[model samples]
Target: MVALIATAFVQTGFAQHDHATHQTQSSALLPLYYNIKDALVVGNASLAAAKAGEFVEALKNADAKIVTGANRDGLLEHSGKIAGSKDLKSQREHFAGLSTDMIALAKGSKLSTEPVYQMYCPMKKTSWLSSEKTVKNPYYGSAMLTCGKVVETIK
Candidate 1:
């Protein structure tokens, strides 16, 4: 009878421990998801603007995403490109190829394992602003891709 009591106690303790671990991991991941979504929205706008040659509209798209708090799609990440306005019809035709590459990056294995931008190339003026890009996407200097992982969690 004593042995039975001890065994049950051990089982109870283990179950509680497992629950706590699961909760911890789930909680840790929530912030990552939110951060990734926000970055994608911002990055997408830049991509769109680069193609359209309208930097202002790209910024607007990014701002809109940040303000709307839309997280319906489960955090798209991967070095993806949202869409940019291509000024030339011939060059615009090249974007379809870009879509394939963007999709692959969006669904990359590191979407959760690592950061979309795990580098540290800060702006020349501010040491605290990572909200913008460091190196222009060479393809379009006006288009930026600076958002990164969630450094801090909300709750």
Candidate 2:
């Protein structure tokens, strides 16, 4: 009985530690994600692709087991699409998908240490994530940099 109690205590401690680690890893991807977004906003497909690669690596390091189901697969698939394409238009297309999945993932995981803005462009009819309250259009770049509005803020 004493041994059983000790084992339970150890398991409980491990579970708490694992939860904290999971939170840290989940939140760690935001800055990388933002970097990718910024590159896209500047109409730099090559830079965006490079950042996407880094995002994918960070996702892998975050541990797939912690993010099971569609969220994990969607992130990997979309980020891969972004990384595999060099064309600015193609990158932005894939980025649309990536942002969709990321918004859901952020909501589900409760990631982002600060509020993440879900900004939407009326012309594109698509949304992207932002660390700030202001809109910086990733789809139109400087052609229409401030074309979007904050539709939602996830904290």
Candidate 3:
């Protein structure tokens, strides 16, 4: 039975597991994530750093049981890097990595309560999440605002 269960788990791609059907606690991440993204969109380094710090704190306290293995670890790692940086450039650079992990977590854990849009910038080859479908390029802020497209919508 143990072997059978393990085999079933292997047959179903673990990272692609449908979390919308399961109960998870990582929705706690959305508000801080959106705030950090907004701060970066306006090119506010200090606010971004503060938001990132809160992001990490909320992540630590989040009931992340739905997120397993490397996904959870990568999220924490990237969030930590963002929290440690006060420079907008550095924070934005690290934010891409954090967004990557966050996207994976959102998809795999279905932790988002409302709709989340996955936006991408072909110019920078980076993607970020947004609460709305409208394009808001956090990577470049007003310098190149609306520079990206919505690639996916997580419901």
Candidate 4:
């Protein structure tokens, strides 16, 4: 996933975008991943060195899962994308866990999480991605995570 995310980052220069369903398990949905990866590029401007590395690592892992297609308990291994028709549990878990992590990061940054929000819903049984959101991620020292959504899935 790190490879895919890194590749996307290299090409897009730090913006999140759907690079077509790479794995057989993918989504036709608008891949709206948190734009916080750009924040990771902030390069210790606000976050500590360790924190920055941790953030990057977390993002890389998530991206890797999406690209590689893990399993039922995994992100990209088994069968699921933003709009996956199966494995919604892991998808939701992935984003929810990410949300939890982001919230904690925001708290540490002395940001107001109250204004922060995330949209996650199941589509049948597959993956669940973010969509049409307007929450500012005060944690990344920027409002990068203000919009997102996953839209399609393979049956």
- Residues 1-155, model 1: lDDT tens digits: 99999999999999899766544443333233233224333444444434333322322333222212222121121112223332332222333333233233233322233333322223322111112234322222234444222232111
Clashing pairs in 2: none
lDDT of each residue in 1-155, candidate 3, tens digit only: 99999988886865455443234447768778899899999999888888889988877766556656787688778778777878888888888998998898778766666888999999889899999888888899999999999999998
lDDT tens per residue, model 4, 18-70: 43322212221112223322222232222222333343344344434343322
Top model by lDDT, which number? 2
Model 1, CA-based lDDT? 0.32
lDDT of 2 by residue, 58-141 (tens): 888886766667887888888888998899898888888889888888888778767889999999999989999877899989
RMSD of each: 13.7, 1.6, 7.2, 18.6
> What does candidate 2 score on TM?
0.91
lDDT for 131 in candidate 4 is 28
Backbone clashes counted, model 3: 0
Q: List TM-score per model, in order.
A: 0.29, 0.91, 0.80, 0.23
Please identify model 4 stretches exceeding 4 Å from their true place: 1-86, 110-155
The best candidate in terms of TM-score: 2
Error of 3 at 78 (Å): 1.7
Superposed by TM-score, candidate 3 places the C-alpha of residue 31 at a distance from the truth, in angstroms, of 1.6
| Span of 10 residues, lowest total lDDT, candidate 4 | 23-32
Model 1 residue 136 distance off true place after TM-score fit, in angstroms: 22
